[model samples]
Target: MGVKALLSKPLAAYVHKKDRSWIENPVEAQQAVFKSIVRKAQATRFGRDHGFSAISSHADFVQAVPVRDYEGLSSYFNRVKQGEKDVLWPGKPLYLAKTSGTTSGTKYIPITSDSISNHINGARNALLAYVHETGNSAFLDGKLIFLSGSPELEEIGGIKTGRLSGIANHHVPGYLRTNQLPSYQTNCIEDWETKLDQIIEETIDQNMTLISGIPPWVQMYFDKLMRQTGKPIKDIFPNFQLFVYGGVNFEPYRKKLFESIGKEVDSIELFPASEGFFAYQNQQQDKGLLLLLNDGIFYEFIPVEEYFKENPTRLTIGEVEPGVNYALVISSNAGLWSYSIGDTVKFTSIKPYKVVVSGRIKHFISAFGEHVIGEEVEKAMQRTMAKFPTVELIEFTVAPHVSQDKGASFHEWLVEFSREPQNLEAFTDELDQQLQKLNSYYYDLISGNILQRLKITGLPRGTFRDYMKSQGKLGGQNKVPRLSNDRKLADGLLGVAKL
Candidate 1:
């Protein structure tokens, strides 16, 4: 990016003031966040007392609004898509971020004016704070590449709207905007055959200094690059400084990606879903720190106390303390109120707010109804993995579905390692039992009796990402769901023909 553009308005704060820490005082900090949506709720949308939304205080509004996922917002978004404004925001939106569904349908979430400004500034502040913590911002000047969704726009009634990444790029400081690498992805092209071919064509021969994307797609792209070029990935992008990934627990895919490239280096994960960029790397190098976007989205944490006890403790950003695991809830400028992002985190320290990824809260399997969390499973897997030979976990999914009629019960595990196991079934089963032993709940379930079915199947070379890409679900926001609770989904995924 040119120095002149980097010195412009939106970037000035990020570029020049990158060294500064957060500036707002306590009360002002609270108010700055509170007003992001409250003022709109009370405006012309509501005539008298801004009669629009009924909830008064922050907590009141949050309490009044029930949590919802993508399906709940579909119709309202369809209206915005039709070029008729609905209640998401008062003004015309700046862009629509493209996202996919479990069935692979496309979603164009509105990028409102407030949301645009909040995202840009919030990202800048995140970078600023990261630089402050690291003591420099030279990475900002490096060639940055995002593993993003397609930049294609769609119109319900023939009016061209914007894709999420394109709009985000469009809003960047005009000077540095051109600094972003060209994306060959089209937001609307989300099918297996059409999208993967384009991803393969567009991503070749680029000097990607900084790389970003869902880990599965990034890994898939690089594998294809290695096959066609017959050279290590390091040779393709010699300037590549870092790997930025998110959308799924990166550990599963990261190991394979690094191995495929024939090397390893430091990496960062940007945990952003279609909702908004929730958190970025805190730059501490200890563990992932969820530096709360104090001003962008009103953040809340639900304590594990609820998991242990009946009533969960919910803490606001201001109330967060050290060593407590929380299931996060967010209310953003884009109109998602008390939205659950489905991940669990624990604060390791307070003053600057450091956190370790605890696990997925309600998103894991409960075979024998044991309620094994992602963190529990991941921790056990990591422990066993740390001692094993250089083996890869090609696929691991837990399915709780049992034949109740047959009285069968157990967590079924499927794994494909890099180095062939001397006794594949025995080794994998022992690992499974060891993992179950670590989580007390799973232990009770298993100790009672043998599981209905526990299977381990080996994947032929290049199966995981090839399947994901062949299915045409590659890019920035989408990822291979690492952990799930459903048995059928697991079975179907495992049974699918190899790519």
Candidate 2:
């Protein structure tokens, strides 16, 4: 074994052991994190305003602070952005993670010095967990690339501000600096297409062993590599053994990705966001990501069904149960209090608290009484795709289609197929059947004649890409919603469908 690989084994073991120390004591770890952040921020403006000093328990904390999305918390954020110290957390934020918001134009989430470790360490531990389990650290000696945003930073209120991925770039560990690929200059290229091209040029012949990114962007990279070399990614980088990804579920893209790779490779799924790094897949056999309990963040779960109610029941880590879908809320060291990141998750294992992100709270199709989520749609597509081995899907989205001319309404699935199924009608039928099996509400709607069977509209090869480009969200953590309730996206897509 190489020197780096030899050293990595013990390091991975140490990290894994330390992780288990907290993982085994979930409740205690979470309670400690909760109290620590609360006590530390007690003197800050937000803390004082929310009665943090008088708070003693979860109930007190809940009463003092209401769960707020970016819009609801904008006032406090505005103060911080305007150079107001101690407005949210103590003094000033180390950096502001700038993310695209739906209702709000742009959101600047605080990343404090104390909280930055949660993001950094979470990523490191994911890799360590893999190394410790499989005893395969040879990849550490080869080049590793994270297909992320520009590393360049702009200033806002004297705090470095950029996309979460970009902010993370500044903190890449010194040990892996040489192994990290796509030169700093290439990474800072701003335009995703240009950056991607440059990345391919730089690492096309390098010893690439690990590739990381959101699935869609990574798929784009693989597609370009195939065009250039006429070979699968495995042939291009024979040593490439790990695929680390986050932002979206990988199942929908799995077939296409594996085809591009030419073989199955061990992969890690991470649940990361601008708000905080919440979880990482710790074991190869498990689909559930191990939620970070002691990581300077206290988690809360509101049953997804109760999310829209006047006052949803907020359950702490200890109170959450396996199989129940919940809207994830967090009070983090990053100065976010009772913040709703909008993502929903269902716990798969509670022994060590592992969760699978179900969908976003707002990203669902409920035009009728049938509320179908991203997970359901993705799962349905996965099952349908399995039966049709020849079919290759590039991307897809689901939106409700309401008829105006006395016609029955139905869910319209906008799909971009790389390879058209032999029988498109059968494919659509299978997809619809899978969805009905997954979602009871959708099944009822279809059975009761409230809605017709779902319809599929094949979009042009680059329709979604063009749409994202038009919206100025072509890359870097941006993803097309899997499901939406309204016709706004559907109408916009229809306008660009070119059918």
Which candidate has the highest lDDT of all?
A: 2
Stretches of candidate 2 exceeding 4 Å from the true structure:
405-407
Backbone clashes in model 1, listed as residue pairs: 97-164, 147-212, 150-185, 150-186, 150-187, 152-187, 192-472, 392-418, 409-452
Poorest lDDT segment (10 consecutive residues) of candidate 2 = 398-407
Taking all chains together, each candidate's TM-score versus the true structure is 0.81, 0.98
Best candidate according to TM-score: 2
lDDT of 2: 0.92
User: For candidate 2, lDDT tens digit of each residue in 214-308?
Assistant: 99999999999999999999999999999999999889889899999999999999999999999999899999999999989999999999999
Superposed model 1: Cα runs more than 4 Å off: 1-28, 44-56, 70-86, 103-108, 122-143, 156-163, 176-179, 183-206, 304-314, 321-323, 356-362, 405-407, 450-454, 462-472
Report lDDT (Cα) of residue 225, candidate 2: 98
Error of 2 at 39 (Å): 0.7
Clashes of 1: 9
